[model samples]
Target: MKYFIYAVITIVGIAVIAGFFIVGSPGLQRLRRLDETRISDLQSIQSEVIFYWQSKEKLPAKLEDLTDQVRGYKAPSDPETNLSYEYEIKGEKTFALCANFSLSLGPEGNNAAIPIPARGYSKPGFAEVNWNWEHTEGRSCFERTIDADYFPLIKDQKTP
Candidate 1:
């Protein structure tokens, strides 16, 4: 039954190839999901800080300063690690936010995601303050600055 043996080997080979993809996809998907969550968490924190600056005319001393019972907003933490995101005030108008990312922002060895635009703040002189969200595997941080002259424009818009 040489033909039967060959058929069995062919089926087994096909099954093995299929199995690899089926088993491997979930792990990759989970990593991508975690990366998306990390991006979302950073965006949330950025918005809160911008809102705080607009309302108070100064940067919050720490991330906790954005927590307010009246607004029902609480600082977000890492989705997979359950650790608090990193924050540091570099200047009166500058701050940095950091997170541990599980995957590269794009294909390997390519910094395709550099200079991600800071959504919602579009004033002419204030354009430079938009934070960059580019990152690689492991820990990455984004720097931001607030131009106080545009604070009035921020006030006119509702908190996102």
Candidate 2:
């Protein structure tokens, strides 16, 4: 009877440990999902900003400036917090995009582990460029500069 009791207690202890992880996993997964969404959202906004500079020959004064119906692009808000991503004009050809991230950039918890994919422009001789958008578990910002020599001609369109 004592042996049976010990076995039951051991099994119960193991079950509790397993249960802790099983219950904790969803929250971790949710955080990772939110981080991924933030990365993707920033990437999209980066692309649109580059396009806007190429077409307009000027940095957008605000995030709202990129939302023209003719461009068919809308700035994205945070997936989890529902807050608008932050944008700031740094200079004539420089700007910054900011977001809140829920997870560290990588398994090692180092910012350098985060990979910012190279974005390619449609223009000739303007090779793919990396924006170096890296983040940690809270708020992070990325700065970008448009090369003046590579500006593409702006397309004329009626404002909607």
Candidate 3:
């Protein structure tokens, strides 16, 4: 009788643990994955914009302007809709990148990515997570400003 009770307890424990993850819902998980992709794309666009600003001392007029064959860099589009991300130049050194997200990410950008996956799960650390990427569901825009001191214009230094 004791062995039977032990088996029941172990099964119940496993079920409870499994239920916790099941509640997360497969569809919801997919949405989260899409949002993750959106964030990643935005980060890439942001880097490209900053680099352009540093080189030209101004924001690109449009996303296409950031594409560089020499650097082998191309602007990424929305993963779910396969549409171009919205880009708007707000000022000489400021621009906004917009995309639609299916779900809201946690404050720390999906802190639940700790446990190892079947292959190996990895969560972004503090330095990896951009503080500006936080957004609610639906359309969100990340506006960036280029600092002149930090991203100075590239000028050819002429030797006298």
Q: Judged by lDDT, which candidate is best? A: 1
Q: Model 3, poorest ten-residue lDDT window?
A: 114-123
- All candidates: CA RMSD (Å): 5.2, 5.9, 7.3
Q: What Cα-based lDDT does every candidate model obtain? A: 0.77, 0.76, 0.73
Tell me how candidate 1 scores on lDDT: 0.77
Off by over 4 Å in 1: 1-24, 107-118, 122-131, 153-160
Q: Give Cα distance to truth, residue 56, candidate 2, Å.
A: 1.3
Model 3: number of clashes? 1
- Tens digits of per-residue lDDT for model 3, 1-160: 9999999999999998797686666777677778777777887888788778877867888889999999999999999899999999888787888998786654644434522122111233312223356676788887877766544566732336
Write candidate 1's Cα lDDT for 12-125 as tens digits. 999988985665456766876787778878989988998888888788888889999998999999989898999999998899999988777744523343333445656565
Residue-pair clashes per candidate: 0, 0, 1
Error of 1 at 124 (Å): 9.7
- Ranked candidates (lDDT, high to low): 1, 2, 3
Model 1 earns a TM-score of 0.70
The residue ranges of model 3 lying beyond 4 angstroms of the native Cα positions read 1-23, 106-131, 156-160
Poorest stretch of ten by lDDT in candidate 2: 110-119
The most accurate candidate by TM-score is 3
